[model samples]
Target: MNPLLKKLQELTTKLDSTSETLDSFRVFHGRGKIYPGLEFVTLDYYHPVLLLTLFNQPPEHWLNENLPLLQENISQKIQTIVVQHRYAPGDPSEIVYGELPEQVFAKRGALSFHLNLAKQQNIGFFLDIEPARKWLEQQAANRRILNLFAYTCSFSVVAIAAGAEKVVNVDMSSAALNQGRANHLLNGLDKNKSQYLAENILKSWGRIKKAGPYDLVILDPPSFQKGSFDSVKDYTKLVRRLPELMPSGGLVLSCLNNPDLDDQFLLDIFNSACPQATFLFRLPAHPDFPDAESNRQLKMLVFELATG
Candidate 1:
């Protein structure tokens, strides 16, 4: 047998059904892999890709083994691995397993992700926004929050944890919104305090504006979306318009995932568009992420904006 197949054959077997989302799958504690109660299983739809997860070990070799491949191909860096539970059999689903790009090797606890079983990409949470997550956790308590482009609602999870009185998550994808809903449930957030909205941001701003005058708003749009935006020329316009939705002391958590644009572009946009909203700080990027000099193609920026 080949090395890969040989590795799989070595795994010990365990079986159980997933009550939360999936029906069932057999679990394997591969000899060389990590965890006891932890398991590796695949979903029916995406079994083509292996879902090496832990009900019980942290993510290991999968990411560490693959980093060289990712880094060699792109200097922009892979800060986290977004591992989603693949629904199909025999596929490459381990690539993006977390919101962050690095293969984190914590000696304790099983690995987990915010990405839902249904989303195509492995990214459950936006890993690049790790620090921003902590930032939100710190700032959002007791505030009225809105999350735009709220994929899987990782930001909402943090905001709710931070004690936000109410959080409205807006997204275009029903699947994505559903995942965010799941997250709110996962974190045991109060049902009455959180709300989910499925809408197009550019067109739904009227509704958003009414719901807002928010104390905290998160804007982490996809780099380029098909129906709603072309992040290149139109992103600044969106940034410019957000001040209308914010209260004087409200904070906007603005993020740009497009690496092609430089940080200076974001600085310029903030300078010109929301001049009244003080630029509190740019949250620190993750450590595992490659240095900016190594990357020439990415422009991921997370900023703290407060309406002064």
Candidate 2:
């Protein structure tokens, strides 16, 4: 057996039917660089579908040789196998084996997020942020949350499901916000408890502020979004404004996925941009996604503003 197939087979044995039914998670994290020669690939088990993503072109015979063996050896519960080529011109996804359901969702506990498997990039939800979602599940009750760069609003869904008083989701994509609304409805969360704003957060502070004095602020912006956001240049601007949007004692869940920027990048921004806010703790990354360099993985840090 190929090393990748052997590793995947070992992982499959660890996931019982009960756990697979309850959550979507990373099956293999090659980008973490723990596994040799597989750094350009990552695989996710989205319940019934297995999505294999290639960040760079693999050897010509690699997939042809390994995919059939993988399909035969992986879990029986995985009915569909899809391959996404990030290095390709369109970053397309091909259904290599079986068929995708008309409606695909990534299930996490009691929450379900709508996924677009055919999309060029990002199939709606992020699996690596499960720890932060679990944290929100514990702390979200009765709190007003402001989710910036909310993407499909997975955080909002988790927060609302966990009994948050209210959640305002802000993103530049109207299409993403629409899916976010659908996610809330899918989870049977009350629409009245949530607000969706399809606007650039930097230019719409007044609208965002109008929705708050938020009790919790979630900052999980993309590393780079072409003309819109460049984390290195724009994160400080967002952090500096948090003090005005949140009240004393409010909490901030600031996250960065860029490997190039370490935890100190956020610590420095919060320390300098919002001096009143004290660094709390960093949330641990999900165990499945382990990086050789700890700092290169996703960073989820919590901060609390001091009482006036």
Q: Compute each candidate's TM-score over C-alphas.
A: 0.62, 0.96
Worst 10 residues of 2 by lDDT: 14-23
lDDT (Cα atoms) of all candidates against the true structure? 0.56, 0.89
Kindly list the per-residue Cα lDDT of model 2 for residues 1-308, writing each as its tens digit. 55568767875786544553747778788998898899999988887888999999998898998798998787777788999999999998899999898888998876789999967598999999999999998999999999999999999999988899999999999999999999999989899999999998889999999989887999999999999899999999899888789765588899998999999999999888899998989999999898999999999999997764
**Tens-digit per-residue lDDT, 122-233, candidate 1:** 4355444667777787888789988888877777777777788888888888888887777667656788887888898888878888776677777788888786887777
For candidate 1, the lDDT comes to 0.56
Compared to the true structure, candidate 1 yields what TM-score?
0.62
Highest-TM-score candidate: 2
Name the TM-score of candidate 2.
0.96
